[model samples]
Target: MIFIPLWQRLLVALATVAAILLALPNMFYGRVEVANDARASIAQGLTSPELEADAGLWPSWLPSGLINLGLDLRGGAHLLAEVQVSDVYASRMDSLWPVIRDALAADRDTVGFVTREDGPPSELHVRISKPEGAARALEIVRGLARPVASLSGGGSSDIEVRAQNDLLIVNLSEAERAATDDRTVQQALEIVRRRIDEVGTREPTILRQGADRILVQVPGVGSAQEVKDIIGTTAQLTFQPVVQRTSNKDADPGAGNILVPSVDEPGVYYILDRAAVVTGEDLTDAQPTFDQNGRPAVSFRFDPQGARAFGEYTGAHIGEPFAIVLDNEVISAPVIQSAIPGGSGIITGQFTPEESTDLAVLLRAGALPAELTFLEERTIGPELGADSIQAGKNAAYAAAVMVVLFMIASYGVFGAIACVALAINIVMIFASLSLLGATLTLPGIAGIVLTMGQAVDANVLIYERMREELRRGASPVKAVQEGFDKAFSAILDANVTTFIIAAIMFFVGTGTVRGFAVTLAMGVVTTMITGVYVSRVLIALWFARTRPKTIVV
Candidate 1:
């Protein structure tokens, strides 16, 4: 007979009981999900009588986690968006002008007066007031270049400045462009994640695709357009010094200033200073609140550095109008009422409460580095997901009944022990998934059915070995012991090989393939424990109590 130690038997029993308890919450998945959501809402300070009562449904001491249903199961929206990375190049060149101007001005003796010339959006052209000074001007601009900040990019400046005739041509270097592209994609991904998280949507998938695209999926969201509306706005908030306000559309504001049309008033344009006093990056917090006049407004607080800068600027520029620009348009140009030292201020834009709230959320989430163009959008409905779940359930039930009946008919009493172990294996698989917060897809259900067959295969090998030993006239005890000892190697080898395959699929595949691999890999582990160890223990216990001289196969 197999000499199973007392500790091993106790350990198996303990694990089995723990798994069943942990998996019990999944039976009440809807209630647990509601409780979790209500708890999250309470933590966010949004409390209601209904929410509190719902939260009370699941006790705090109990494990309330449920297996997260993926998009195919719960139904939601999917969107693919490509980031306009080239847009950053223009802005980069525009910002480089001041640095170039200051650099060239330092060598006034060698380089004469410099002026920016209109050129292609990708290139910055600087005109040397004196044609002969182009070489010196180019030298000075190139000297300003620093090493690119990237692991793969060696020592190379961000931009390459070369002299072309009387103009200095400047464009982003190859290494610098790669670095900027990576930074832009990462920034866009984070911004999208934050925006989705603010809405309290559960398990939104935001990942970078290729060189310049992002894939976003939000489960339980109604439509793709709704997600777009939330994250589409650039929300490029900037505060600029107002140069002049003009009603004439044809007025020339000259260099170093931009003409932006007013957002609140029609046919009015404001010439604002190109350099911003402060941008949205300086904002620490923002919320939708009522202004002094009880109108919907956005209240914002600035970081420490921003507070000091704003205080100094407002103290010196009292009575001057400051233009608040959003997405390159002047929203309002309010005159400085007084020397306001505090960093907190309210913005009134004649907005509805919904608009105000949305603006505040955008501000808090930060701005996207580049604009995203929607390439594809799709919405999956709950009805389809429900149908899928029903089909999967039927298939699982059919598979389970077949496996159970086959095991009972083939090995009789020993087959019944294997059936008990198979049930525990299923429970353990779900418990492990719940503990790990793994998502379940239709393919994952298929993995479970596949595990059922593999689970019984180990039992078949053991029973066949015992029958062979009995045919050789070996005693019952020796037959059982030899059966388990011989079958152990095959069981271990088969499960190990299956585990390796599942691991490879998980790492190499995406989406549904990964879901399948997760369940399949987990099933292998649970089967090894319940199938080999638990089955052996059951047989050993039966033999200890009933030592039959001849066993019925």
Candidate 2:
């Protein structure tokens, strides 16, 4: 008589039950999603009556994970941005000025008075009073160069120093520039990812497309402009000593000073020191809060180094005014009444509560290394996603119905068993997706439809084998045993080859192609379990209940 081991049968039953449980949440997707969001909010210390009610929609004991929908199946914003990597070169040169000045100052008798001359942003030109000291100036400047900090920039220094006439010219080395460009792009990618994650958007596809481009797809955002608003602001916060406040927009602020317009005052400007006492990079934490006058503001704390620098600057300039500048505009210029320690401060501005919250998020995410210029942007509508989802459902349903009918008509009892296995295979596929938190796209749906047809191939092979055995006058029990035993090898081989192809696609493809590969790969695993093992167990149980002398293959 055909039989299956007790332990094997129990294992299959347990897996089936577990898969069904895992997949149950998807059937109530809307309710489960609301419960998930509410739970997240509650965990973050936010609570209200509506939140409590929503959180109660799903029991805490049940699995809450769901397959995330990809951008093609969920409305969102798409942006293709190119990072201005050259901007960092200018910044690097600007920051190097003080070091170059101080280094050359030690030998002032030879180099004479050093003054910076206007030139390209990427190059720093320092003019000395004595043209004969050019070689000495170049030596001092080159001494400040450090080895490039990248593998590809092996023995190259970060800066190239050379003298032309009475001036010492400094520029970033080519290798160093290449490394900086890569680092700038990578930093921009991570900052964008963190900002999106802070806002709790789900499964955003933020990827570096090329050398200096980033591709961002955010599901559930209203528009591309909204995304740009969140990420495009440089958020370059700086604290600089104010030279003088003036009403003229075009006033020249002399050497080593910049004229910045006030954010809140019309046509008013503040001439501030070029070098900042501290910048946003030193910030360790930031949060949204109200000012003493109950206006929305952001509070920030700094790291140890930043704290020391800030404390020293404030202590030395107790009676001086310092401007809190953000993105090249002065947000406020308050006079220092006393020395402030601890490196903690509040940024007061004309901000609403939402604006303050967004600012806090940006500060906490850290500033982008380079500015981004958006080259292309598009917003997908929810109605389009809804229609695509419906179309996918219709296609899946049609595929399932046709597969079910064909299997039943072909093998009769065996075909019915195959149909049951096919249903279980689908549930297991979805369970795997939910557990792995994979994103499902429109192409992913097509993968599932394709899997339904392939799932029954194992059943067909076994039934045909049984027919061959029966024609040779084999006993009914002998035929059933030999059918499963002989057909497993072919089943394994077919699924294994398909699995290899899926793996290749997953690794080599991008975006929606990977989505298709994910579903197809998951289907291969489920097909082996449900189609081969489960079908055999069901057949064994069927034979045990009613042992027939003769069987129709």
Candidate 3:
């Protein structure tokens, strides 16, 4: 039978148990309580949007205020989004172009110029009287191009492209030297949060670091698909024609006699509008407040045109009600009690503080250009998450029992050595996760189970090799050495492929896929170490002293 030194074996067994204990507690997350002040510190920089985006970020359900569950353990939704930076860059460039245009046109004497007049967002055409002088004018526009160095990739390569002649071409990066900072991933995170604000989330946590990838955490949200819809779609708000408002025909302040078209179903409402007078583009802020009659309501303010139209409409209508609608649904209708002079006013109606707060959040985040449909939805309650975790644990325990029994029964003593090392590999995986602050998802657990199987894969190869060497009449030491040597390449290639797949999962996949990918990656790495290397060391030391010839065979 395979014989092992007691001291070495005991040391490994203890280490394995300790690693499991450290990682076991984190499998489920619930609540933690702390002093109010500590909780307050944790609450720092946590805004409504932040809290709504990440329910975990706030000490909402946790009275202890200590630890919270991640999506993996707690069973929350995960989202993946491919961000587009072109729109944001084009917008910023468009805004700055006006300032540049004014500055250049002001110094007309410096260089004679003819405006291309009509040009795309980034493309400008100009005919200069003195072609040589156009370069100086170009310098002014070029001076304004600081190259948006942001955390998101959108603005990183964000340089102002100067086309030949008097034309200013604003292509991102044509040269080999591209600026870096705000990677597309960071931009996506921020943009997604903003969009979530527009739609209002239960609570989400979005963090950004990578160039093209972002991490989004949503607690208590069951629908990954719904979250994706809200965050993924770019709600390009526009002012369309109001064929009907919620109420009857009314005159808008600026346009005179404004009519917004709308149809109300049992619970669902739709406002069919042609063109909009003013959309969310001019909206600045919206808040909930008590009107003059102490009625719960919301107050909104618009930018220049929005303000002017609002003011003129309210002033002229005097008694008619103006509708505050969102996504074609009428939120509130408040009558013109008095003239709203400054482009800011309040909407008084039947609304809870929560509803008002939600409305305010939506407006502040901006609105969708048109209506949206829920293509898909799925919900996972906390109970379901608990059940899933329990089921996973049970399965793991069963699998471990079966694998351990099989390994020892088949190979006798050498098989038992592999089992012990395999156990250590599992423990090491958990320990590493705890240390790394990685969440153990259900998929992650599956990854671990799969890893447990693969953990033995390397050992099996080496053990088989050693057995073959012994049959061929090689010395025990030479068999062991040659077995490890021969199996190295195969293990390397197989594990490397798995590692690459995990990397891809981290990049393209979101939420659960990512969790599985992470655990798989970590397990693969540790399996190589503990399963292949660590197990060999322990076996090597034992064989050196005992010098067993026909080991447990």
TM-scores for the candidates? 0.91, 0.96, 0.52
lDDT of 2 at 328: 94
Give the alpha carbon lDDT tens digit for every residue of 381-479 in model 2. 888888889999999999989988888787888788889888999999999999999999999999999899888888888888888999999998888
Q: Which residue ranges in model 1 land beyond 4 Å of their true spot?
A: 1-3, 59-61, 249-256, 301-316, 337-346, 544-547
Q: Check candidate 1 and list the clashing pairs.
A: none
Name the best candidate (by lDDT): 2
Name the regions of candidate 2 deviating beyond 4 angstroms: none
Ranking by TM-score: 2, 1, 3
Writing each residue's lDDT as its tens digit, candidate 3 over 420-485 gives 788788878877776665666788888989998898888888888888898999877778788888
- Candidate 1 residue-wise lDDT, 140-171, digit = tens: 88888889999878888899988878889899
Show the colliding residue pairs in model 2.
Answer: none
